[model samples]
Target: MAASVIELSDVSVVRDGNTILDSLSWQVADDQRWVILGPNGAGKTTLLQVASASIHPSHGSAEVLGSKLGAVDVFELRPRIGFASTAMARRIPRDETVLNSVMTAAYSVTGRWNEEYENLDVRRAQRVLAEWKLSALEDRKFGDLSDGEQKRVQIARAVMTDPELLLLDEPAASLDLGAREELLQLLSGYASAPSAPAIVMVTHHVEEIPAGFTHALLLADGAITAQGPVDEVITAENLGETFGLNLSVTRENGRFAARAA
Candidate 1:
């Protein structure tokens, strides 16, 4: 069996006396690509935070990349994990160049702040840009790019470090049809590659899940309603339960769509 990338045992997180995650237990293997689906306030983002080591569970055992949370230094552990989210994107300077935005991830900083990078780093960043189809925009300022371009940039930066685990918080959110499909194609390619790291993406819409994702976890009210192989866990029954609405789900050409039943 593949090594476990994340292991959460009876984990619970409480904030302001409200339970965010209630005794949740789950595991993600290094070879798996998982998509988390849930409605608003379902604690999906919070779960990603635990996997990223950005937050420790208020109770229960949480381990990421073989290191136990609260026992290991998060700063060191975080470099081995790639995280891309709107929160992280906001920290990036608007004036920063695309190449610099990605290169600074080598040091885990938001912007290029006098931190020196090696020749190898520059080459690697350039290569990543090319791989993500952003080579033409390398010199462009991050703020000047379209939402699609910026989303791709964020993902490129996340993978720049060659992290062991990649966590994306709604990578396709707010994108137009063209942009969303473009990003999904790139994500599917990456997720299907043998060298790709274990990935977990949180999104509210089933349409955003890229091909090659192997597993699914449906969360509701801070708990797992269903989880396992993507094919089995993403059924209409599961979707309906998670979202509190009767939903019909369909799959075609390795993609999924859901609608009200």
Candidate 2:
């Protein structure tokens, strides 16, 4: 069997006397692509934070890559997990060039500098940018790019280190129809790559799910509504329970779409 990349057992998170996540258990095996669907404030982001080792669960145990939280070096663990979110984007210097933005991820730096990088590292960064179709934007400042372009650049940066896990928070949130479609295509390509890492993407819209995602977890009221293989867990009944609305979900070409029943 493939090793489990992420395991959470009865995990819960509380903040300021309020419970944000109730006891939850989940396991993600190596090479699985998961989609986390939830309404706002359902703790989807919190779950990703735990998986990325950015936040510890307030109760129970969380294990990532055979290392349990509170028992391992988080700094070392963090470099092996790629994370991209709007919150993270706001922290990066807007004036930094696209290439520098990706290169800084290797060192977890925020901005460009005069320091030198190894020739191989530079080439690797360029290669990722090219793969993401951002080679032309290498010289462009991050602040000057469109929202879609920024998102692609951020994804490239996230993968710059060849992480074992990749977490994407709402990668399609601010995109227009054309941009969203383009991004989905890129994401689909990545999802099908044999060398791609395990992936978890958080999104409210079912349309944002890529073509090759294999599993799903739906959250509501800080609890899991349903979770398992995508074809079984993403039914209308489960989605309706998760979101508190009647929803009819359909799959086409390995992609999902939902509508009111």
Evaluated with lDDT, which candidate comes out highest?
A: 1
Candidate 1 structure quality by residue, lDDT tens digits, 20-79: 999999999999999999999999999999999999999999999999999999998999
User: Candidate 2 versus the native: TM-score?
Assistant: 0.98
Computed on alpha carbons, the lDDT of every model, listed in order, comes to 0.96, 0.93
Show where candidate 2 strays beyond 4 Å: none
Worst 10 residues of 1 by lDDT: 108-117
Residue-by-residue lDDT tens digits, candidate 2, 199-248? 99999988898988999999998999999998898899999999889988
| Count of backbone collisions in candidate 2 | 0
